[model samples]
Target: MNKTVNQKAWFLVLPVLILVGFSAVIPLMTVVNYSVQDTFGNNVFFWAGLDWFRDMLESERMWNALGRQLVFSGIILAIEVPLGIFVALNMPKKGFWASFCLVLMSLPLLIPWNVVGTIWQIFGRVDIGLLGYVLAKLGVNYNYTQNVIDAWATVIVMDVWHWTSLVALLAYAGLQSIPDAYYQAAKIDQASRWKVFRFIELPKMAGVLMIAILLRFMDSFMIYTEPFVVTGGGPGNATTFLSIDLVKMALGQFDLGPAAAFSLMYFLVILLISWVFYTVMTNLDKRDGV
Candidate 1:
């Protein structure tokens, strides 16, 4: 005799489905509507076909912002990934110090994004901020407001300080999951530190490393508030990434049609990259017998 499956469990998820439809699907549909139409005041909208999309595709301003965003994300990944791994490796594996280190690493990740920006903004001031004051006192001529290089460095360092903890935490979790047997076998073989890390540790951490990479990539690409608060996209628009540009179009200039088009394209780029990362992660899991 075959046993019947209970289908009533489906009802349990209905409320969540309704909530997502209202929160996500409806808003996405509204954006789609705005993307293909032009609107004036008083809710009057005219069909513009793909005019806004074509215009966005051709806009040099958008292209420049895209270039800047790609550079920033690339820099962040290059610096954070290895640094996080190194930190995780050096952390105490067991004891009170391990718990203390974990807590310290988590503190940065817990701070609000806007607050991180504000803290950095005040902290980098050339005259009043400690960093700026020290640099000025040492006659380094540091001013993020006036110097493009200084502004870029400040933003990059701030991001590293704030988000490196996340990478460390993930890597630490990956490290914790490695069984003692692996270490014992390596030790029995008289394996060197580098060899053990290369053959044993790195391979085991691959899954979590990929996850950390994907999360960091998406977050860095879509970063807006922190950089916006710190720089205001100033110093001649040196730090204005795609998100800031989209906001300027949508709200600053009140160009809804183009802004919606820009946003959709932005979403597609992120979706495509995320798909690629997911594919890599799945393949890694298969190879690692995870």
Candidate 2:
């Protein structure tokens, strides 16, 4: 006799399916619909076909924003990964201080994105903000609102401050998962600190490091709220990324057709890059038997 498979699990997942349909699928369909059509007053729409997509692709504004976005993401990954690993390596493996450090690291991640932006915005003001005031008192010229380099530097530093803890916590968890026996074995071999880290600890942390890199890459690439709030894509668009450009096209300029097309392309670019990153990293992991 054949045993009947239980099907009740489908019912358990039905609510999530419905939620995703409403939250993601429906909105995506709407964007796709808008992308190929032009609308005038009173909701009259005409077929625009690929005109908007072509316009966006040829637009120098979009290309500039994409470049800036890539640079920002690259800088973030470079700084956060190494800094996070250093912090993790120094943390106490088993102690009350470990718990305290974990809590301290989590505090930054707990802050709302908009709030983080706001805090940085205020913190960078030259007339009143502590950082700007202190810098000015020391004869350093720092103004994010008006200077291109300052704006970029402020945004990068703010991002590092707000998100570095996430990387640290992930690395810390990976470090904690290594067995004490690995350390004992390394000690018996009279391994140097560098040798122990290179031969054992780094390998053990590979999986979590992969996760941290991916998460940070995606987040930094799509960053909007923080920079938008802090710099408002100011100083002659020096800090304007793709997301800000899209918002300006859609809401600031009210070019719905172009904005929709721009958004679709933006989504695809992000998806493609993220897929490539995942593929490369996973293959490396498999090669090393991670």
Candidate 3:
């Protein structure tokens, strides 16, 4: 006899589907509409074909912003992935100190992005800020509002401080899932620390690390609020990533048509890159049997 399937449960999922349609699908449709058309005040819109897309494709400003975004994401991944793995390796596996350390590591991830920006903004001040004052006392010429390099450094350091904890936590969880039997076997074989880590732990942690990397890449690429509040995309647009540039176009300049087009392209880039990351990681997992 065949078992009965519950069709009524479908009704329960309908509310969530409706909510998503309103929240995401509807807004996406509006953006698509705006992207391919021109609008003036008084609710007037004219079909512009692909004019906005062509303009955005030719815009040097968009290209520069894309380069900066790529660089920023690259730097963050370079710093955070290795740093997180190292931190995870050293982190206590048990006891009160381990718990305390984990809690401390989590604090940064808990803070709001705007608040993180504000904290770093004040923290880097030349007068009242401890970091700025110390740097100034040491004769380091540091001014985020005036120097492009300093502004970039400030934003990079702030991001590192804020988000590295997330990588660490994910790595720690991956590390924890490795059974003690692996360590015992390694010890029985007289394996070196590096050998054990390379041959055993790293392979085990590969899946989670890929997930962490993908998440970090997406977040870093689309970062806006914190860097916006920190640098305001200034010191001559040194820290203006794509999202910041998109906002400047969409809201600051009120260039809706081009901004909408840019948004659509940006969404596609993120989606494409994330898809590549997932594919590569999945293949690696299959290869490593992890």
- Global lDDT scores for all candidate models: 0.94, 0.93, 0.93
TM-scores for every candidate against the unseen true structure = 0.95, 0.95, 0.95
Q: Which ten residues in a row have the lowest lDDT in candidate 2?
A: 281-290
Model 3, 208-281: lDDT tens digits are 89989999999999999998998899978888999999999999999899999999999999999999889987
lDDT assessment of candidate 3: 0.93
> Per-residue error at 209 for model 1, in Å?
0.8
Between prediction 1 and prediction 2, the one with superior lDDT is 1
Q: Highest lDDT, which number?
A: 1
Prediction 3 TM-score vs. true:
0.95
In model 1, where do residues sit more than 4 Å from their true spots? 1-10, 287-290
lDDT by residue (tens digit), candidate 2, 1-290 = 99889999789999999999999999999999999999886899999999999998999999999999999999999999999999999998878998999999999999999999999999998989999889988999999999999999999999999999989999999999999999999999999999998989889898899899999988998899999999999888999998998898899988999999999999999899889988998898788774
lDDT of 1 by residue, 128-241 (tens): 899999999999988998899999999999999999999999999999999999999999999999999999999889889998999999999999999999998878889999
In order, what is each prediction's RMSD in angstroms? 1.7, 1.7, 1.7
Distance from true location, Cα of 183 in model 2, Å: 0.9
